[model samples]
Target: MKKIEAIIRQETLDDLKDAMLNTFEENPIGMTVTQVLGFGHQKGLKDYVRGQEVITSFVPKIKVGFVLEDKCVEQMIDLIVKTCQTGNVGDGKIFVYPVEEAVRIRTGERGESAI
Candidate 1:
């Protein structure tokens, strides 16, 4: 299995959900969505704080993550990129990892089944 982590612009969340729902052949996979703060080479931008303008090194982002079967990884990655791209800076990033294992506590489903 593979874990897909997408750090995307907060504004794009709704579109991402819609696109994912429309594209996947299987039932919708479960996901974890988190609001986070960080910066890249962009280092955020200047913004007014306490009546003063200053470089804000940290900015808000939405990290959407889920685990998928190996066969679905590439297509899902393409869907994510297609749905999330804004042709601008701070569009965010994606990360993929090999999932050693996963489990659903109540159902006791593990591996791909757990997903």
Candidate 2:
């Protein structure tokens, strides 16, 4: 199985969730949301009118995650890219990794079945 993690603009969370729900069967997928802060090459610097320092600090972002079959990876990535794109900075990023194993808490089922 593959674990897909996407860090995206918080503003796009609702739309992304709605799209995923529509695309997949109910209960076949799981999702998580977490608040995050970070900056890229642009950094947190911003120009000021009076030459005063404006500390942007960390920018707010949302982290979304789920487990899916290998076949579903590309589709999921496409959906996220399409839904999250705004042609602007801080659009966020996506990461994928192989899950060593998964186990169901109640039934103790393992592997892809556990997911």
Candidate 3:
């Protein structure tokens, strides 16, 4: 198993979800979506507050993550890039990690079946 995590622009969440749901038709995909604050080269944005300029160093982003079979990792990465890329600096990042194991609490299922 592998874990794929993507930090993406907030506006692209819906499109990413639709693409993943449509492409993975054979099996239901389980995922977690979290609202997060982060910064890259873009370094957040400048805004006016109370007639003063303010730089918010942490920008709002969406973190989408899931654990799935190793065979599907590349496919998911492609889908994420295709669905989220905007040719902009703050588009966000994708990270893949090795998963040691997985367990389903209700059924005591382990390994890929548990995923």
* Candidate number of the best lDDT: 3
Model 3 stretches with alpha carbons more than 4 Å out = none
**Residues 1-115, candidate 1, lDDT per residue (tens digit)?**
9999999999999999888888874677767899999999678889888999998889899999979889889988998899899888899999999999989999999888888
lDDT of 3 at 68: 85
lDDT of 3 by residue, 1-115 (tens): 8999999999999999888899998887798999999898998899999999999999999999989898899999999999999998999999999999999999999999998
Q: What pairs collide in candidate 3?
A: none
lDDT of 2 by residue, 3-43 (tens): 99999998999999989988886545789899988888547
Task: Estimate the TM-score of every prediction.
Answer: 0.91, 0.88, 0.95
What lDDT does the true structure give each of the candidates?
Answer: 0.89, 0.88, 0.94
Against the true structure, candidate 2 has what lDDT? 0.88
User: Where in model 2 is the C-alpha error above 4 Å?
Assistant: 45-53
Give candidate 1's error at residue 6 in angstroms: 0.8
Clash-forming residue pairs, model 1: none
